[model samples]
Target chain A: MRSLDVTKTAFSNTLRSKMRTFLTVIAIVIGGFTLTVTSGLSAGINQTVDDMLAGYGEEDQLFVMQASAMGMGEDLGPGPQPYDPEAGQQSSTFGQEMLSETDIEFIEGIDGVTNVEPIFFVSPDYLETSGGEQYTLNSLDIPADGPAMELVVGELPERDAMEITIPDTWLTMLDADAEDYEDIDPQIALGETVEIGISNLAFEQETVQAEIVGVSTANLAGIGGAPMPSYALNDELYEIQNSGLDVEQPDAFIQAVVDVDDLEANEQAIKDALQEEGLVGMTLEDLLGIIQGIIDAVAWVLYGFALIALLAASFGIVNTLLMSVQERTREIGLMKALGMSSGKVFGLFSMEAVIIGLLGSVIGLAAGLAVGFTANTLLTGGDGPLGGVGGLTLFALDPVALGLIAAVILVIAFAAGTLPAARAAKKDPIEALRYE
Target chain B: MIIRKTESIIELFMKEGVMSTPVLETENLVKVYGRGPAAFHALKGLTFEIHRGESVAIVGKSGSGKSTLMHLLALLDEPTSGVVALDGKPVTKLKPKAVSGLRNATFGFVFQQFFLNPNQTVLENVTLPLKIAGISKSERNEHGMKALEQLEMADKAKNKATDLSGGQKQRVCIARALINNPEVIFADEPTGNLDSATSETVEDILFGLHRDHGITLVVVTHDEDLAAKCQRRLIMQDGHIVEEQTGASTTTPTAARVPAAPGERPQEQPSRRRRLMKFGKGGAR
Candidate 1:
């Protein structure tokens, strides 16, 4: 018989026992749906991580710090450690080991290290607007090559200009009177001047006036939406804070940013080199690897359940085809007597299985896409749980992965069909014709 | 026009004194059901020759081996030890594929159960043989319609087989058997499940095809009235033919047996020694 005719007949035969076929298809549907949803979930989360990574600086940059600064080797065993005099005399701030000028020069000399700059820690007490209304402030001195911020209406501050960039959330506090934060335009705060107050070592307050060069949107990497100051303004503030006492302040910092070539290939080597110098270098991947690992583990666990479901569904396919073959014994015998070959009979049964697989997977994929896209829309809309996280999609479908999943299910169905098909093919025409 | 053309050719051969060869010949045909002492001998050394355009019936009671003999003759089963020849060629050496191909091209069958797929339409059921032969859909449909028209079943083409009456269903089977234009038609108790009136109608249709189209007809039945309608009869008992008779309707009754051909052995009783040798070969595997 023609292959097309066999396929057509097989499809029609599947419709003979509608309830049986439906139940088998439902089993496959459960497996397919679970597989599609989990794959989409993995895609969505990985895309979100990529978006967050873009907000950080270049991938080849690392934040280096003193290894002992975070109390890594500190003794906490209910006894005071015998500290050396040299260790006690080392400059420290806020219980952290400060990096001296010698440390910066040493890092610059490290092989493969292209550039190294000390990160100055700045703490401003408050920001007083022209209306004399003072609000508490948190500030960061972003370097020229530091992380790029997503802006609302203006650009980053000029490196040499005495200017600062505030977060978009501060627009209402800076310009509004009726406490309507959503109605305030962030562009209105551009070019505005504010006085930043800091405390000197002698407890004297020193204020510096700086222009607002930009407004930045809130983001996951920014933590609490800290304002950023230009390099010139941060230097001036730091110099004023240290001019209080007769003793000359030491040039020390808690951390430094390092730039390197071929960071992906040399990251571990550079980190080992820094470890010998009593320092630690952390890449962005190093900081976020734990999160990525957790997401991957969860996706795999879900996929495991989906695989188990598919295995059970394949058994359903075997059972259904076997029963159909048993019921059609006389029909098969008649066809054989009419000169239909055994191979054609086998092809007919296998085609039935493939049709069932196609039905289940197409329906399951459509349903999964419907549910996934709907959930993504609801979760990412305004006032939703993920609304605060910009550019976040909770479910993302990859067409290639979906196609592979469907093809795999069809193969499993065909494999499950072979046993029954062979049984039908081997049936003796005389015996089958005589079967009651 | 095709029927007249076939008739003219047959007449021409007869006028020229050309002897027509037998369509089917079987010699020393033996069929056993099982192995060892429990073996049931179904057909024991039955020898017969059926010529073209002949209507023959093998009539016997149930378990008399008439069905088994018909199955072997139809190439549906292998003989325990014997030879079944079709068109003067020994078929035992043919591969399974060639055997099936020969059956598909040369023989059509109508069963007592009227083995039509009840869910399919009459047209689909009738065109099954052509479909199995891999004929294109449009061509098969055209041939199917012509066959159904010959059986006076053209109007019922669109109806389901289950919706047809017993006689209508039998006519549909006859239409299916005629669809491939086979040389031989094997009918197993064609009237066994029909009423008397329907049986007569089916009988008329079978006989009409034999007379008009010059197709060989082989019928297996226990009904004496049905057997007498055929031109020849072989009455079987205990797995072998015990009597041969010619019907009253035939003008000439040909000899039931032909002499053994050159290099062929005469028919003999099925011997235990030959069966034992066959069994030993099977046991060694």
Candidate 2:
């Protein structure tokens, strides 16, 4: 028979047994819905990583940190780690091991290294605004060639200038019950000077005043976190806080930044150079890879569950088509008697199966997309549950993903319909016509 | 159009007695069900021939193998042994595709049950065979409507088959049979489900196609009156032809075969015909 007639007949037959067809379709819907939601979640997490990682680090720069000899090859059967009272103190004074002038000069002398920047991390006692409001501050020196942090208001601090950039979360920290603010001018105006203090080991506080240069939308100071300081301000505070400690030259440095000639080609060479000094190399992509690997592993587990649902739905298709074949024995006989080839008979039944699959996938995909969109919106909207974290969505679906889902469903339905269709095709016309 | 031209040339050839081939013929046909101790023979070494434009009826009680013979001749079943030919071509061992091609092109069938698909409209039922023959949609509709019109079922083309009465359903079946314009039409107890009045109507339509369109008719039935109406009748008993008769008015011949008359060639005669009708003048030749 003609393909058009075969398809039309199969479609009409599908409608003839409405409840059975609907029930079969429901199985597929459940499977496809689960699959779609999980895929969307995977896409959403990947998109979030893309957004965050875009602003993470510079292409040609790597962070070099002192490798701890004590932690290497130490697999002390793990419970709560051995409480070392000096561990916290060591981390607190980590920046006091700042690279000396000679070390910096030595790093700058490396073959492929263009520049070397030493990071100075400092903890300030309190930030005092002109209005006399005092708040605790947590600060670090921003890297010179790192990804430019996205800003909500004002501009990045000028190089070698004592200016600080604060995150949006600092506003909430300042006032416990702050209203949702669109711009940050209410809490702290840009270009306004704020006094910061750091107490030296002598128990006397050293206070330094710096201008607020920019406000960032970074999640640096998330809920209950501390604010970030500009590179120059951090360096200035480091100088003022350690002056009375009698710490002239640091023994070891926490971290240093290296600029290389060819990032991809010279990365290993630079890493080797850093390793010679007992330091480790960490690039932006390596950090991103660690985060992505964790996310993808979780997503695959969720996808496996969706596949189980789809497998169950395929059985539903097989059962429905088998029943249809049994009921249409005489009709099939009549078609064969009318000179329909076995191949055409098979095509007719297969078309019916595919139509059922198409219906299920379409409905399932639409419903899945709707649910994904709503969940994404609720989680990522301004003032939504996940609103505090910048550039994060909970669910996402892409065109290619949708197409693959449909194709997978079609294949499953086709395979499930095969046995029943073969039965119908191989049926003897005489025996079928003789069937009561 | 090629089939029509071929039929016309065959008609002219028949007038000159050159290409007078039977539409279908079976030789030493055999069918057995199961094996060994359970074997039951359906057709035991029977041979028969059905000629073009000839209306022949095979009358018998149940299990006399009339239906078996019909199936073998229709190419719907494979004989355990023997050759079945259509238009002088051996078709018993032909490939499936070629057999289906011949079934679609050279024959149509009307069963006792009417056999119309209840899910389809009357028009769709009529066009089914044409669709299987790979005719285009537009031409299928045109030929289907023409065939339905011939059976006077054109007005009810859009109605579903279940909504039709028994006689109307049989007429629709006849229309479906005629849609492909086959050389032979098989009616297996076509009037068995109809009342006497409806049966007459169906009989008239079946005979009308045989008479007017020159389509060969093979009616398998147990109705003696219906069998007598055909120009020739074959009586079957114990899976073998017991008797043959020509016309209802003719006297019954004995079991002995008739001797060939002088100046008559046995090879030229397909099946028994009372008188040859003239061709190209709306008369059977």
Candidate 3:
């Protein structure tokens, strides 16, 4: 028959058994809906993480740390930690760790090292703000005159101003009230006052107030601290305790930032540079093991549930189609008797499955989106414990993740509809004729 | 609408390229059910030819392979190495789609069980074959209504199949079979489910179609009295054609050509249902 008429006919009787159609569609919808929501959430999380990572490190950044300390009591980047037995086993991870400051110098001297900034840091004592804001202070020395200019906020801190820059997030913390602040703007404002203090060594626990000369928006949190531009981030400690012969040079900024030509291309040379400086420098990609481990755990849980729902939905489809085949037995035989080829019989039944699948998937997607969005809102909107922001918890979505989720849902719908259609197609006309 | 007659009854031989060849033909057809372990034989090499301008009856018991023969002859399944032809095409070796296509193009079928699609209207059921054959909407409507008219159920076109009476449903089944103007038609115990009175009336209508339209007809039946009304009879026993007989005459008297059962209704059975077929006079005969 004509494609239109056949489709109309197929659609017309698909719901002949109301309960069967309803149940089958429900199963399929549930399977599809869960898949969409799970995938969407995953996508959103990944997007936020991408933003978080891009602020500090570059993509494909490789970190090379000495695999084993060999009980030498030497520290890698984090601490005097032992190497993982799985270290160096994965092909995509780890470059070389035995690097030097001369290596950094050499990378800087290379043609592609367009703007290299060498950073050496010291971690200072935790300090309370003038506004009573508490923060762990880390001091970093970046090349002020050169390529690090792109990450500059308002202006580079003058060596004499004793100035230090802070991130825009610090403002959102509302140190005055210490609570009740929301990120209501697309871009945070610049220029504000922040406080720092060193204990008894500096002004009897007095807060060292600094004008926020600049704001640095590049993702500094990824590098493990609030990054400042100059070596004087803890200038008061030296002015108060060092030259007076009362203390040593003391901001205690324990880390550094070094720029190379390109992270992915010269990762080996950069690792060489950090090793020469007696510091273990690692790239964002190199430290992704914990991230990968987390990802695997989440994926397993998501896929496990998805598979269960998928199988149940598909089985429901088979049952629906089988019932349909039985119900249309006489009709099927008549079609054959009227010269309908077995192929047409197969096609009609298969088309029925496709119809069911399509309808189920569409419904499922709509349902999933509705439920997922609602859950997301409830989780993020309430005064509940889970409704947190920027403190080791993020819930958001991205376009790539949404697309992937949608594709998966559609594929699931199609798969759920196939088997029963095949069964319908393979039904015997003679037996079907005999079917009551 | 009178066709050329070589002997007042033209025989359409099953051969290639002849459009007017008998719409259905079967030879040495056998169907054995069960496998090597049980192997219950169903059809036993039954052979037959039904030509245009004839209505033939195949009489047998339930297990006599009558339905099996119907399945094979209708191209529902492949025979056990038997050749069946439709419109001179050797369809035994054709693929399933080709068989369906031939069936759609050259034949209509009616069954004792009505076989109406429960969710569809009388019009939709009757329009199905024409739709499958890619007939346009207007044409499908015309043929469908015409077929319903032939069975005296034209007024019930929009009603669901389940809503029709047992006799009315059979009439709609006949209407569905006649919608395509196929050269040949097959009926499987077309009156099996109806009351005796309804059965007699239906058989009369079916036989009337054969006389008036010159379309070939092959009917499977359990009633000897119904079988006797056809122009030819083939008695099957356990899948074998045991006997054959021809009626005294195949022609209808000029005065008796009141109306064909496929194209139009007899004045007595149906009280004034106008022929709704706009395609051709033959369909509204």
lDDT of each: 0.80, 0.74, 0.59
Instruction: Tell me the tens digit of each residue's lDDT in model 1 across B70-117.
Output: 999899989998899886778887767667666777789998888889
Best candidate according to DockQ: 1
Error (Å) of candidate 2 at residue B175 is 0.7
Q: Candidate 1: TM of chain A?
A: 0.79
DockQ-derived CAPRI band for the predicted complex in model 2 = medium
TM-score of chain B of each: 0.82, 0.82, 0.76
The TM-score of the first chain in every model comes to 0.79, 0.83, 0.64
Ranking by DockQ: 1, 2, 3
Q: Write the per-residue lDDT of candidate 1 for residues A62-91, one digit (tens) a residue.
A: 778888874553345877767754445445
Q: Lowest-scoring 10 consecutive residues by lDDT in candidate 2 chain A?
A: A218-227
Q: What is the lDDT of candidate 1?
A: 0.80
